[model samples]
Target: MTVALATSLGDDALILGQRLAEWCGHAPTLEVDLALANIGLDLLGQAQFFLGAAGAAEGQGRDADTLAYRRREDEFRNCLLVEQPNGDFARTIARQFLFSTWQALLFPDLAQSAAPAIAAIAQKAAKEVAYHARFAAEWVVRLGDGTSESHRRMADGLAWCWRFTDELFMDDTAKFRPEWDSHINATLTQAGLATPKPVRGITGGRHGRHTEHLGHILSALQYLQRVYPDATW
Candidate 1:
């Protein structure tokens, strides 16, 4: 359970960091571009810590880079939400808003985990994700209550993001749901958007059943390592 838990957390951060890094040079403004880059760096750091802990726990001689770059799609255990494409600014914000809010609630409790390494990672992550949630929420409200086009786009993005949310709470993270919903509801209300009613969401990412996007991500992520065959700088 400890290994699986840490691996999952690491995978989530790694994949989402990659997704955010995609916006590094492409955001609508330079300010947004830098913000996404910094956020991606933060997540990458968290991924390193958690995956390093997992590798240590597994006693397989694998390190963070090995676990991150060597794993196949079926071996990855990240949640489905983080793997979704960054469709538009609104879509990206919706995904971040949803996932960050959950992370904000989750890491506080994770700081209490019995595994001291995991607990320490969670302790530091709690502060980072609080800012992440707030950043995303500010955009959520700005776009959701903005001009007609922005409002429509924000609503559409939220609808796409909403289904994957159920999967976030499906595992041990279920304990955080009440707080998650409360924060989500308040944010949406403030944004002038309706709180989406619960529905049966797509699952299986946690068990290594992933969408097609992950395969593409891995091909790019692992290419250098695979080509070099463990060559290091």
Candidate 2:
């Protein structure tokens, strides 16, 4: 269970890191570009720690490199929300706000995990994610209230990703639902955006079932490893 938990966390970071990295030179402004890239690097660092710990907990010879570069799509455990494409600047912020909010709630509790390594990783990751959530929340409010077109895009982005929010609480930490709800609601309200109506959430990403996007991501991530079976860094 501990190994599985670590792998799940690692996968979340890995996939989201890849998604954010896609924005490296493409963000709206130079500052925005650098911010997204820095956040992506932070997630990748967390991924390395968690995936390495996962390999250790499982007593497997596989290390973080092997796990990251060799896993097939169905073998991954990241939530579907992180794997979704960065549809637009607004969509990316919406996804970041939603996922980082959940992370802020989750990693603090995980910092107290029975496993010392997990606790350590969570302690560090929690700090980074707290900032991630704040950064995203600020953009959400700015875009959601700034102009007619910006507000429309922000609302559309939230509605696009709202269905995936339920899966974030599907684990044993479901108790955080109330806090997540309050934070998200307050953020949206302050942004002059209406809260989206509840939708039936799509689940099962935890069980290695994911949307089509994961396969494409894995193909790019694993291409070099797959083609050069004996290559060394």
Candidate 1 residues 16-104, lDDT tens each? Answer: 99999999889999999999999999999999999999999999999999999888999999999999999999999999999999988
Output the worst ten-in-a-row residue range by lDDT, candidate 2: 109-118
Model 2 ranges off by over 4 Å: none
Model 1 TM-score, 2 decimals = 0.97
For model 1, what is the alpha-carbon lDDT of residue 55? Answer: 97
Error of 2 at 230 (Å): 4.5
Question: Model 2: which residue pairs collide?
Answer: none
Clashes of 2: 0
Model 1 lDDT on a 0 to 1 scale: 0.92
lDDT of 2 by residue, 1-233 (tens): 87988999999999999999999989999999999999999999999999999999889798998899988888898999999999999999999999999999989998986489999999988889999999999999999989999999999999999999899988686999999999999999999999999999998789999999999999888899999974898
Tell me the number of clashing residue pairs for each predicted model. Answer: 0, 0
